[model samples]
Target: MPTITKSNIDYDKRNLSDKALLKLYYNMLKPRLIEEKMLILLRQGKISKWFSGIGQEAISVGVTMALKPSEYILPMHRNLGVFTTREIPLHRLFCQWQGKASGFTKGRDRSFHFGTQDYNIVGMISHLGPQLGVADGIALANLLKKNGQVTAVFTGEGGTSEGDFHEALNVASVWQLPVIFCIENNGYGLSTPTNEQYHCKHLADRGKGYGMDSFILDGNNIIETYSKVKKLAESIRKRPRPILIEFKTFRRRGHEEASGTKYVPQELMSEWEAKDPIENFRSYLFSKKILSAEIEDQYTSEIKAEIDAALDSAYAEENIIPNETIELNDVYKQFEYQDIKPNSNVKELRLIDAISEGLRQSMEKHKDLVIMGQDIAEYGGVFKITEGFVEQFGKGRVRNTPICESAIVEVGMGLSIAGMKSVVEMQFSDFVTSGFNPIVNYLAKSHYRWEQNADVVVRMPCGAGVAAGPFHSQTNEAWFTKTPGLKVVYPAFPYDAKGLLATAINDPNPVLFFEHKALYRSIRQDVPTDYFTLPFGQAALLTEGESVSIITYGAGVHWALEVLENNSDISADLIDLRTLQPLDKEAIINSVKKTGKAIILQEDSLFGGIASDISAMLMEECFEHLDAPVKRVASMETPIPFIGQLEDQYLAKGKFESALRDLLSY
Candidate 1:
């Protein structure tokens, strides 16, 4: 990778035509005026909040003008200029700020928390760095499709401190993706100054460590910003590779309207104010004969008028109610991918083999499907579930990712956004905490935020019976179950595991597929040779009885079965909830109603776990039918110990049986 010195572009020798120059100015000016109006409205208490990108006009508009209209851009909060450049109507933007029904997210989100499929612009979440990796995914998809396009994702100087920034840049550089990491080095991360943030003089220098071509330029010079980005974009189109462009700039306003600038020194504010991007660019246009004083004045007035009209119209519109049903709409979509015809030829396979076969078949069916994880490629995963997959499907589809959980899921988000199905795996389900942001914020909310279908599946090897210790053995299904747009599937048996995983891959939203580590090799069952799908939110009646109804999933189903078979006098009904998110409410109610007793079981921690949710549902739905209090049997609340005997005691079968016996007797 070549390293170039940072410099300012000469306006006298600039290449952009006069017409294009005026449009660039307009793009920058529009956002500035809109932001000014937003501040005024905020003061009057019409709008609730605002993140002023007051001094960021050039960085936002310049880079936006540099890219092709077809390319994708994941914008930060300050990049309102990107939205304007991409033709997001001013009225809609105003409506969004006013929390009106016509806003980009239909008022579900505020402060640039919206994306438009039509514009190919992904809006930023409060957590900004992860979107960089999401952009890498789109770039990856473009490369795979042989499309001549590039992705430009924005960030700030302070955002560089995040682990996601490193992970995103590393992944993009490793893959040689066509992504531009455009950083606005505004000298401060909120209240903290740049000197305190890092020792490095420039943030772009970090790109060199990742083997990415990097550049730094004067952010206030719109011509320089546009010219450099245009050159980089052209190069990226020819050969896909990540590049970093750090703009030397400053934020003139406080972090937000409510955040006063008492922390900022007066000397620094005056210096930045003098070099205001909008004023500097306006003077440059007039001095260069690109525009007369009269024309500049006329354009500024017209822009303000346009903004005022938009604001007036926005205020006239009705405020959004954020109705529960509508806010929860489009959480999950019912999907049937190919017919699940039962095969006469049956084979006895372990739970792991069935899941592997299901993945293999799904890959064979969808050419655009990609499986990504740390050891999933050469090592075939820790348990050999994805073994031999690389030799069969090639490395492009079955990728070996760095040990960055967040980027892995964000890559899935990018691929899904670019119209491909992606399956990601965590080496251990317990490590999913690292990737929780992308999973919950990006993957889980993409559908609700922008109505964007993130057809991604995250495979997690979970549970504690295998004695993998605390880090390896954890049932974290409750985390995803509470998340709205995610589907949590934990199948106990081989047939259900294969069938449910198939359905998850087909589902048009993010699915957290939890495969019990203990059940993988221990459990063997007759699985159909051909493809099949078990519908989500439906529970299988493992055993029917009139005394107690045992509602459980994953390895807990096996425990319930063992109890029912051995303790014949108990006369309990066992229900296996294949999918936890779209829970089998009907099956649970009907069984509880029939037996008049309910026992919720899970391998997760007893308190605030999935069992608690099940117990709550049983109480709410089957309260009248219950003959006793809804009991729950789960692993001890403490972390799983290394000792085998202690672990057994932690999830003792006797504990579960005791709960069932109490429920039955009651």
Candidate 2:
């Protein structure tokens, strides 16, 4: 509705000299050269992947130049120009392209991804969106550290559609976070043009709806891009709210090395090229007589030599890609999961109570921990996992928020990214669909991208059986179990909950801890009052059996235990997959081998469930140990019905019974 002009911005009055002009131009040229070399590397098949920021260099360089090394940045994939301003080694860029060890983060920060801890910059990009949450987090951390630094996060025109984009902006606006959101709106989201998909003509228009001060500028025009963004960056740095500047530019190349970019119209391409920011800036400098033609040539030659030398040194010194051995490393916390026998004090209690007790205990132990959710603070959460927490911890620590699922997760990731160990208590697990944009695109891939974990725990009450109806009850873990950079811990018992929750807090990864609403108050077991922890990425054998291996976790572990206890004919071994991603392959394979049958059980649908992924992992890694086709016991491939009988019937895990019968027959 309204735009803050340069005069209105506080930094507008700040003077810019010719020296400042030269530095900005140099940054643009340096990145442009490095990106071009990366393209050559990509085309020649030297690099596996490349996402170029050739045309949209103005915004990247502009905003980054404005930020100090103390001020952090959470850049998306297309912000190479910013990386140049941060002084990321050029050879490291090349080594990253070549997948060499000497590359950024020693091969961890691969193509289209880069991070250096030296600049106080924590980089994160799902290559999707939601990185703004990360920016808010880094900014929050800067605040905690009392560092007078602003956090700038970058995005694209297509990113505006994501729920996390809105979540981040809204959270920052509300909290007055020192964040500058730079959206490089290069028109097309891969193949879909913004004009064709979205109703808004200007991408920045969406930011205003979130109450963020938003602006749209020519991303290719260096002078305007820098002037506009620098002002906003400086303003946010001073007051620390949110301001989104949509840099309108065009991708000089395809979305990635694999993309051909044939979808872009010739007219749009030619028009954007005609207004190239780098060329425009160069012209501006030449016309001002700031630098002679000889000086310009030397400048280009100097940057090119720097790139070549960096590449040579990087290639000669070391490779970039992380050692293949680390594939299983960093995937999960290395905590050793042990069966801590229950003491006399650890009396059997229902599961929901046990989980609640664990939450209370963990919160008591860790003062830095903050618990937030819809009804969690005063209402004790929907499942009451946080019951009495507000009474015990008070409003500051045991907090409540507005009904914003995306905002909830954005806050969690932000707090976690900062320094506070915050857990988001979702009323029902099914509502995760509302916040899926931020969770999957940002939280899921955050650590892998930044090499820093956003240690936020999303405590959602999931699963069926309570028949809370379709909207209230659904197992949504299947949506994210396949994601790499996350920890999904579904504990079946109070002991497991306490141990795992403790483990989750200690973990340097984002964890989705599903406390089944069905089991919360109903189930009980002897849980230790003493301090205990359970490491993720490991499974446990509840019972030893020779007939079949019942592979499950969370509530399914209890169900498998029941089936095994009742029917002794088919002695089933229960293996609880404690952590979904780092998946306890060693435990799973060992159990499957010992008992040559697998019946993976979960409350999710049989189709496209965690069982499929778990079974595939077994087949690929320990396939030879199988005695029969790996089976899956899950709910019917439909939403949980409202009726009780229908719910019970639909909740059937065919594999648990059928697989047992088959094993018995064998």
C-alpha TM-scores of all predictions: 0.96, 0.80
Tens-digit lDDT track of model 2 for 549-603: 8888777877777777777776767787777766787888888888877778888
How much lDDT does each candidate structure score?
Answer: 0.85, 0.73
Alpha carbon deviation, residue 11, candidate 2 (Å): 15
Name the lDDT value of residue 251 in candidate 1.
83
| Quality of model 1 by C-alpha lDDT | 0.85
Cα error, residue 176 of model 1, in Å, equals 1.1
Clashing pairs in 1: none
